[model samples]
Target: MPRSMTLLVLLAGAFLIAGAAALWLERGNAMLLDLSSSVSSFMCL
Candidate 1:
């Protein structure tokens, strides 16, 4: 039972880390897209 509990805790930690990493990556992508769009509009003007 103790071993199973430990395994569960580890799995939970892994999932949390993965979620945080995905969120960070998505935010970075959005920032890049926004910058690119702004640059294109400025160039057009």
Candidate 2:
């Protein structure tokens, strides 16, 4: 039982590290566009 608990903890820690790494790698790859121009166009219409 103790061994299984240790394994579970290690697995959880690995998942957390992997998730953080993915976010760090993707931080600059993700793009957000300016929506104000589109909103203004819609308002003009």
Candidate 3:
């Protein structure tokens, strides 16, 4: 049980890291046009 829990934790961490990296790489283009031009803002803020 402990081993499986550890593996699950490691997998979760790896997925999180991978997702963060992907988002960082695509940050410049992400959500660029999701909103209307009048409502668009930097970082969607």
Candidate 4:
């Protein structure tokens, strides 16, 4: 494959891994709920 294509594939793989990690860490709904609540309050102000 071309150099650019190889780089793109590596980057895409890394992004997928990172996203999977983040979702795993936030497996429970509590954290997201808290975050959304904070954002909602901030938006109302």
Candidate 5:
């Protein structure tokens, strides 16, 4: 595979892992309040 394609695959895998970790840490709140709070913070800017 090309270097760019390999890099893209690695980045995607890392993103998935990080997302899973955030959800695991947030527990049930991951789907709702977590996203809402982050959006709200962005809106405040």
Candidate 6:
């Protein structure tokens, strides 16, 4: 394979992995935030 093609493929793979990781982290953070908010509301009452 040509050098440019190889580099493109590697970059594409990195981008895919990064995107997946970002999505996973974002979901976890959202869940944590929701849980914290609920707990705070319960404590206030």
Best by lDDT: 6
Each candidate structure's TM-score, on Cα atoms with residue i matched to residue i, is 0.61, 0.58, 0.56, 0.58, 0.59, 0.60
lDDT of 6 by residue, 1-45 (tens): 999999999999999999999999898998989999999999999
lDDT digits (tens) for residues 1-45 of candidate 5: 999999999999999999998888779676678789989999999
lDDT of 2 at 36: 58
The candidate 6 region of ten consecutive residues with least summed lDDT is 24-33
Candidate 1 residue-wise lDDT, 1-45, digit = tens:
699999999999999999999999899998989999999999999
In the range 1-45, model 3's lDDT, one tens digit per residue, is 699999999999999999998887687454554544547655577
lDDT of each: 0.96, 0.78, 0.77, 0.92, 0.90, 0.97
| TM-score preference between candidates 2 and 6, better one | 6
Candidate 1 residue runs with Cα over 4 Å from true position:
31-45
Candidate 4 yields a Cα-based lDDT of 0.92
TM-score of candidate 2 relative to the true fold: 0.58
Comparing candidate 3 with candidate 4, which one achieves the higher TM-score? 4
RMSD of 2: 5.4
Q: Enumerate residue pairs that collide in model 5.
A: none
- Model 4 TM-score on a 0 to 1 scale: 0.58
Ten-residue region with minimum lDDT total, candidate 2: 28-37
